[model samples]
Target: MQQQAISTEQSSPLTLSVALQVVSAIAVGAALLFVVGFAPMDVAHNAAHDARHSFAFPCH
Candidate 1:
């Protein structure tokens, strides 16, 4: 009877790397969505105004 050894060299690292990347992407995306989505209209406009002023966009 011959016993065969399983090699996980190709599968394990690749799977872990992909899983980490996916989790990280989801986390960052969710944070951005929360920041953008939960803002009131006036607050959002004011933040944009401040940003524009910082960049010297001349909104006035």
Candidate 2:
């Protein structure tokens, strides 16, 4: 009979690398949403508006 070694510590599903990636992705998404979705500045809004038109997004 072969016996396997049992781990005393439990492994976490959300590791350090995964947590960092999640945070970075959230930051990037928030930045994009803020800059493009509803930009306060005119230049940013115009740029995003052009991009939306290019993508066929109807924005009045």
Candidate 3:
């Protein structure tokens, strides 16, 4: 006998909300990284500068 896996179903509304939240979080994180990788002369600025200088990426 073969066993089948059971899956839990989420309502469409709940699924959409969760998906939106995940996408929003990803966007926020990307924005933060862009700032950190492009902003010059600040706290996160160091990360940006290093990413450009040591990593051979343009900071300008």
Candidate 4:
């Protein structure tokens, strides 16, 4: 009788690195757009109001 083994240790690290890179990119893009696109006080306020309602963040 013979036994076979499967290995996953080699592929997980590369997958994790790629996932982290993608998340970092999305975060950077969101930050840049929010900061640069909403520099004015009124614009920022309006955007926040809309976002709060859309996402149900509850700003009160």
Candidate 3 shows a clash count of 0
The estimated TM-scores of all candidates read 0.44, 0.49, 0.52, 0.43
lDDT of 4 by residue, 2-60 (tens): 11111233355766656666676787788876654544566675667766556654444
Per-model lDDT = 0.55, 0.61, 0.59, 0.56
* Total backbone collisions for each predicted model: 0, 0, 0, 0
Stretches of model 2 off by over 4 angstroms after superposition = 1-14, 50-60
Give stretches of model 4 more than 4 Å off.
Answer: 1-12, 40-60
How well does candidate 4 match the true structure in TM-score terms?
0.43
Candidate 1 lDDT, tens digit per residue, 31-53? 87545544446676576766655
Candidate order, lDDT descending = 2, 3, 4, 1
Cα-based RMSD of candidate 4: 12.8
Number of the candidate with higher TM-score, 1 or 3 = 3
Worst ten in a row by lDDT for model 2: 1-10
Q: Model 4 Cα displacement at 16 (Å)? A: 0.9
C-alpha positional error of residue 57 in candidate 1 after TM-score superposition, expressed in Å: 29
Candidate 3, residues 1-60: lDDT per residue as tens digits?
011111124345666656766676787789876776766667766656756677665655
RMSD of each: 12.4, 12.2, 9.9, 12.8
Candidate order (TM-score): 3, 2, 1, 4
Deviation in angstroms for 40 in model 1?
7.2
What is the C-alpha lDDT profile of model 2 across 1-60, one tens digit per residue? Answer: 011111213254546546655666787789887778666777877778977667665554
